[model samples]
Target: MNASEANFDGIVGPTHNYGGLSEGNLASTRNEGQASSPRQAALEGFAKMKSLADRGLIQGVMPPQERPFLPQLRAMGFTGSDSEVLQSAAREAPRFLKLVSSSSHMWAANAAMVSPSADTADGRVHFTPANLLTTPHRGIEGPQTQRALSRIFADESRFAVHDTLPMQPMFADEGAANHVRLCEAHGDAGVELLVWGREGLGAYEGRFPARQTLESCEAIVRRHGLSARRTVLAQQARQAIEAGAFHNDVVCVGTRQALFYHEQAFEQTARVQDAVRDAADGLFDPVFVEVPASAVSLNDAITSYLFNSQLLEIPGEDRLVLLAPEETRENAATRAYCEALIASNGPIGAVEFADVRQSMRNGGGPACLRLRVVLTDAEHAAVLPSCLMSDELYARLCQWAETHYRDRLDPADLADPQLMTEAHTALDALTGILGLGGDFYAFQRV
Candidate 1:
């Protein structure tokens, strides 16, 4: 049976703004107080999805969660109407309000870790929404993420959606952004690479926090019933973390048999390679493309997001293509390296840049914007039809964003009670667009 990889990109939410919530993410912190263009941001994301779909690739859309998460505010003992609650929170605790209103969910790569039916023991796709316990803003996304995933992959006979791990420091999981799967083809049994930032409750002496834990990786593997023989665990380099490579995907990405990564990406690079070779023994010969620090320093890689790219094995193409961010081309060092790479006649034959500067400013790039899920024809068909990207959907989404999103949003704008109304109204309309039903949002359930 042949299967293909689908990129399910989260649509940029209506409340897109800069709050500097992620402590370890340098870009987010650096651009904290800057105003954002929510309308342009959403349009850029939609354009990227449409481009991929036009290129004969499978692209899907994940609608954003309702913003100004009033339920969470109400839970915090803020008693009043929705507008009054917003006013009270703004007057009393603006930081808490910003945390709940964050549009970080646009980065779908951190949404979940997916195991294709080809790799799972039960022959069904499995999804485990990340606990994201390292940050208060992201930690609140699990419940909504689970609900959204469940709605999209509703066929229990073909898809198994599991609950998130317990929310504890010992089980901090950051989803597919910290995971990679490599094989000869999408349908083949693959080698699963589970990357962790630290061991359970262990001390990390780096300047930045290590989000993924070793115990969480093991728990996900066990819950997904992955083959132990084909699973390899590796720790992320503390140095990379200190340099602001918050997720493994920031410094590494894999597709088919090729792994493109910065040399400093793993603590024990040789051991990781050897384990991968052993696991992929009869399956496929792993191709490792290591970029030395001398060529492109860790700082340059993080700034340009060179490795935070979607490495795609496009249909009818003999070699892979790197869907990189436009920032990679703008940076002198990374640009020169990309030119040399294309001329080197390597497995990665071409490098294309996407203009997702809105997302790039906040520490997410092309890879960060989407979650990759490999599915066979039947499994693909099992997915909700409206959720899949199409020419019609793209046009509709563009118009929808123009109609609902604000042209410019300052951090202070979050305090306005009308913004909350606008966000909920947009989300309510989006549920209809995605066919997710009226009660998809918490407000609707109430």
Candidate 2:
């Protein structure tokens, strides 16, 4: 029952633009109202998947959700046909239209929380889509994410897809962005580390909103039936949150038994490490690779998204590789830190930079654009073949993006009825490409 982790990355949608709907994301806020190239964005995302697949790592794809989310507009009392709804919303409430038309789902790390078969009680891979209740634009993603996950991981005996937790502020879940698992091997029973920003009912006076709640983490643990002895819950540093580390992943990431993070990633850093070590007592000794604040300040780390890189166990590599965003390479401090880190003979043997500037502009890095699901051979075989990446699939996806996606899209373009039509048409064809049924989207449902 040897297992390996698969990264399912969300395809950048046709409506990709800088909406700046995310409050605490500095990049998103900074790049607000800028024109975006949907064609380039989608292609860049595909290149990342192709690169990983070329390295013999399993790469999967998740289709983007339907944008302009017409149903939401209709629910908000915007009457008439789809085109009319777009026009009316544009004329009356332009800001609301931009929020609903956001393509932020391209960051799939917030798609769901997954537990490998070795860790779950039933010996099955489990998924619970995040409610994403912190932001209105992202909150609309739960239903579609649930549908997509259920469809891709449809086999009953091998996988279990649970409904999202109650969509309440009390149960504000941001999925894997605030979660990590450390293990000796991909197949081994791992210690799950769930990070929380604030208590559900507690007040936080931080400059930014605290997304993941302690109660939400507990709920997922209960739903997945994870062993209490093998779980560790830690609070995200308040300083880090206010510093624009909106999600814990912004300041930390873990793979296998190595936890690479910033110094201020957690409130009680030593205790969190001790708890993780205790949970992993007999299994494996956890490696803590802490990047001191002096070496790479919290602002530098967040700005460069150095910690948001993916730590991977490549096939031939003895040590893990850090797949970071191009921003890390561009930033002087993070670049020096990476050079020092790889040369130090540590668990991270190599550092690779990926050009995901389109996503980066919207505050997502290499790690944010993916959802990791560890699966045994049997569970892997059970996944929908079309959802997995192949050379042929990549080619087809590239052609699809070039043919369907716009070369450029601006905030003003969101008001055009044409953009909505183009989005629906592209997504409709994409359903066939991904083997998602025709009724996969809200517009297609009718």
Candidate 3:
């Protein structure tokens, strides 16, 4: 999510985010010394990422042309020497296993965490199975994706699988593709593959209809058939007045679906709500989390910002971690949800309010950036039983970074071999202990 007080003039900005390539990025070439320009850095990173993909070290990629922001990214020194890029991608492999679903760029980039979003990292997987066709954007290209995939697969020791449905035009029928990817994801680890089907969700990009999303949900139900236990919740549902549901954006703990007015109206509020209910009914048992009347309105909250509250649907007794800035005024309802986790202490864990301001300045948040590499119940039981260890990877990498590179190199210079090797080693150790899954998640470009 782009902060309101962001330095738009810097390498990162709306222009880059919206797929616009600018002179600022590529204007400065590698003719300079050790420091690289944003475009140069991104290109270097992609070159390495590509190598990893070629070797099958990582699973996904992002065509450079489509990114448009590549030129600016190059300036940031985000890329690495070819070998180092492969190592970096290899180190991140294990973390992508836990992811089941994500937004087009959001999940692929792992936009919230400290790791590189354009490439794969913990909790973010980008590769889609052959069953799922990739969507084509304006400037993104094949080599970009190929290299990105290589970077994702760079580490031979770490492996993961991701099932992706093809990105068909909004007007095309993608139900079959959606069903196929979902099935693949479902069969593996707890991750569940998803499609941006429009069935009942409303129009997206003014293309795919709400009906398509609903239809996709329906397909999931019909194919897998809902589990015996499934609960539903509404975005505006309020158990109490001020405490229950806040008008601002909030996520439902049950369904793991984000609900709010999109850029365009979805027929009517009641209609959208009804569609949600119907979809729930068709797919799983309904336990609607009611949305209060006050919550009703037309506005678009940064969808990428709602990861912790919206996307996570952890099962009972399993802890859920949320890392956010404490100073930021969190929504009351969202706070309540976190409180619920704390109150349970029922093996359902929660880590609250970690300060990552500098990280956020780079663009991303806890969920936006972090990808969970879930070990099987068997795997978790074997290694560190306590989830706390799982949470320490980020900090551990930070410590390694501070001791080895931070004092000498800028955060943007992480792609350097000597510097990033420390990071890669730290990550390698973490993934080894954590044990990422196979065919459950992938790291690829969009």
**Model 2 misplaced regions, further than 4 Å:** none
lDDT of 2 by residue, 345-434 (tens): 779999999999999999999999999999898888999999999999999999999998999997899998888888989999999999
The ten-residue window of minimal lDDT in model 1 covers 199-208
Span of ten consecutive residues with least summed lDDT in model 3: 2-11
What digit string (tens of lDDT, one per residue) describes model 3 on residues 1-446? 11000000001110112111111111111111232223232222233223322432211222111222222233434366444433443355311210110112322222110111112233322232221222222112223333333433443223232322224433222221121111112113121323232434344432112212443333333333333223111222222112211111222222123232222222233654564555444343322233233432211112223222212323342443333333222545444544653575333255346343222332233332222322232322232221122225334423433343233223233323453344334333433333432221122111
Q: Candidate 2: what lDDT?
A: 0.94
lDDT of 3: 0.27
Model 1 segments more than 4 A misplaced: none
Q: Which rank order by lDDT, best down to worst? A: 2, 1, 3
For residues 1-446, write the lDDT of model 1, one tens digit per residue.
79999999999999999989998899999999899999999999999999999888999998897888988889899998999999999999999999989999999999999999999999999999999999998999999999999999999999999999999889999999999999998999999999999998667666889999999999999999999999999999999999999999999999999999999999989999999999999999999999999999999999999999999987777789999999999999999999988888779999999999999889999999999999899999999999999999999999999999999999999999889889988998999999999999988888
User: Residue 64 CA error for candidate 3 (Å)?
Assistant: 19
- Provide the TM-score for each candidate, comma-separated: 0.99, 0.99, 0.38
